[model samples]
Target: MTVPALYRGLFDDAALFPPGDLPLPEAVPAHAVHRTAWYAEAVGPFLVGAGRLAELTAVLAGAPLRVALVLPDGAGQLAPALADAGALSVAGVELADPDVRAAVTALDGQLPAGVQAAVELPRGDGLPAALDVLAGTPYRAKFRTGGLAAGAFPTETELAGFLAGCAERALPYKCTAGLHHAVRHTDPATGFEHHGFLNVLLAAVAGPDEKLAAEALAERSGALLAAAAHDLTDDQVRQARERFTAFGTCSIVEPLEDLAALGLLTAPAPQEDR
Candidate 1:
């Protein structure tokens, strides 16, 4: 299965591998991020400006990259910061406000050849509608992403609704933030506890029966792929929770080594992907 690495690209460092390495196996770096007025004041618009966009594109052009460029899906205008960025294949819409429709409509075909129009389901039926429109065109299906703005992780039922919606629509989705750990582990790097949001893999395991799938995901307190997350008793769950919690990405000692061995993330995937 192809696992797309969810990148919260705030850090200056790489997420999946060492910074200097270009390719690794079975992982695609997702390089989309957001900016705020406060951020501009703190870091300056130069990083979020058009020049930055061009530079970003150049860096990822051959890196098996799926970059999520945040278009100001509000004013219905591509920020001058993005105007000269030149050819983005994946667009991650920031729907903190409810102006997504206007934003995408304004882009129309200007949204690069084969570019995806990702709409966060902030409000209304816009995302489904937008996905439907993008699918009929030559463009690949737009991504159904974004849920972190709500301040709390999704409840089991809410997540179940999302999974059911994805299955019904046949859309493949990905996420960021709150999902930093490989499993339901604490950030060994930071002492704070992270909510285990591993329902992603359980949806894969349990298939499409929503209730069965949801119950399947909710039962685990760790990454779903690990042996510990498999079918278990309440007593086992209670006792194993601490053990299931991972210490850090350091625990990823081997698989990452294997991906590096395969040279997966370096050069871009061949033409079929492009």
Candidate 2:
């Protein structure tokens, strides 16, 4: 099945990250399989932290793996990580630092040609300043939508503010953590409220209106959200995706299941068949 342009490269494979922490040895082969699946267009590059480059390269045995290198320790690790990424196709780079200015300064002219970079901004008071710093550069923005702790998830109002800020600057952005599903719903086991990836797409479609974006984010009706998404014009879809970009998800299968259930994607075959 041909994935829609809006959903193509939407789900970055983060199987190596927490919650799904599949060992690198296993994760590499699993990622290779995902890249060849029917829904391959929906999958983006594999995400690996800078610290794990050695371990990742060791397991590859010369097999090529595309990756979004994450530098959680801050900009100081960017240089050595890139230097160490032998044979790994570094498609993108992500840096999470409280000092957004410093991070931007450190990342200036550091990446190879064509490798995109995203600065994970700190939420709340300093967010605007961070976005302002990134606005002057080519690097995109990254937001943390959910995490292991309940506190890691941003409220609709907070996220709406972020969407608005980025839209105002015409800055592109991506999201990570807690967006395991495609629609807004409460996790039954942990009771952690997770933001739906579709809701976020709709919110981005809402543009710079924080109130409308927040309303979109808060919408839980699957049919309503799916209908809105389906009704989007080709240009609207382009504009929304241009600003929102993609998100990191641990389980590619779960998202495929959600999209299929919403009628956004054809139901994929069983795990064994895939």
Candidate 3:
């Protein structure tokens, strides 16, 4: 299950989200399986909603689990909730708050030490301001790459601008939603065009200008994306990862399978995946 160094800790388990909303009972063990998989190095922390803290605690009992918190209902009770879940190690937090400044202020006040945070910015005129607000803070930027419907996905132009904004600010970021495959492709069933994770990875690494970035995101060829990834030097890959970080996926295997298919990652030995 060897993967390019650029993809280490790239897939954060989001099995609790839509499209594959595995119940805690099912998701907990499935995440554990991913933690031990042959390509386990590519897997990041388990994403759990702030409200689901108690349920996750119950599922784990006394065992410790690495987690990235999602504040779907704002940042209410986040500190207390994490305090109560002594068995869970906090890796980071992600949330989309309309009042970016206030939310970041409150986060700085309540966020525990050593726990990283990301604030999602809308794909609109306010993005610049939001990124500006985050410029000096420890908080990073987050963007939504795709969703269930066509409307849920950002256009190539919009996505490219977002990447360019982050690159200009030297802000590290993460992406969630709609990136199911390694290369951009239109889904036949939904007629929705999904951005590819590999495309985004390369874009972040190169920090291309807006036009070139948009072109990269719109690329549908797996070979081109893989070749771009292969061309990057180790330092460039590391720099790109520092900016791109990881992305959330409903199923960890999907990304791994896609990488294997694209020859970016080596397939596991038969029966070795388990």
Question: Number of the top candidate by TM-score?
Answer: 2
- The sequence of per-residue lDDT tens digits that candidate 3 reaches over residues 149-258 is 77889988899888888888888899999888999998889999889999898778657478888888888889988888878887988888988999999999998889
Better of 2 and 3 by TM-score: 2
Reference-based lDDT, each prediction? 0.37, 0.91, 0.85
For candidate 1, the per-residue lDDT at 186 reads 40
Q: Alpha-carbon error at 69 in model 1, in Å?
A: 0.8
- Give the clashing residue pairs of candidate 2, or none: none
lDDT, candidate 2, 29-106, per-residue tens = 999999998889989999999878999989988888889999988888888889999778999999988898878887
Least accurate stretch of 10 residues (summed lDDT) in model 2?
A: 265-274
Q: How do all models score by TM-score?
A: 0.47, 0.96, 0.94
- The TM-score of candidate 3 is 0.94
The order of the candidates by TM-score, greatest first, is 2, 3, 1
After superposing candidate 2, which stretches have Cα over 4 Å from the reference?
267-274
TM-score-wise, the better of 1 and 2 is 2
Q: Which whole-number lDDT from 0 to 100 does residue 215 have in model 3?
A: 86
Return whichever of 1 and 3 wins on TM-score.
3
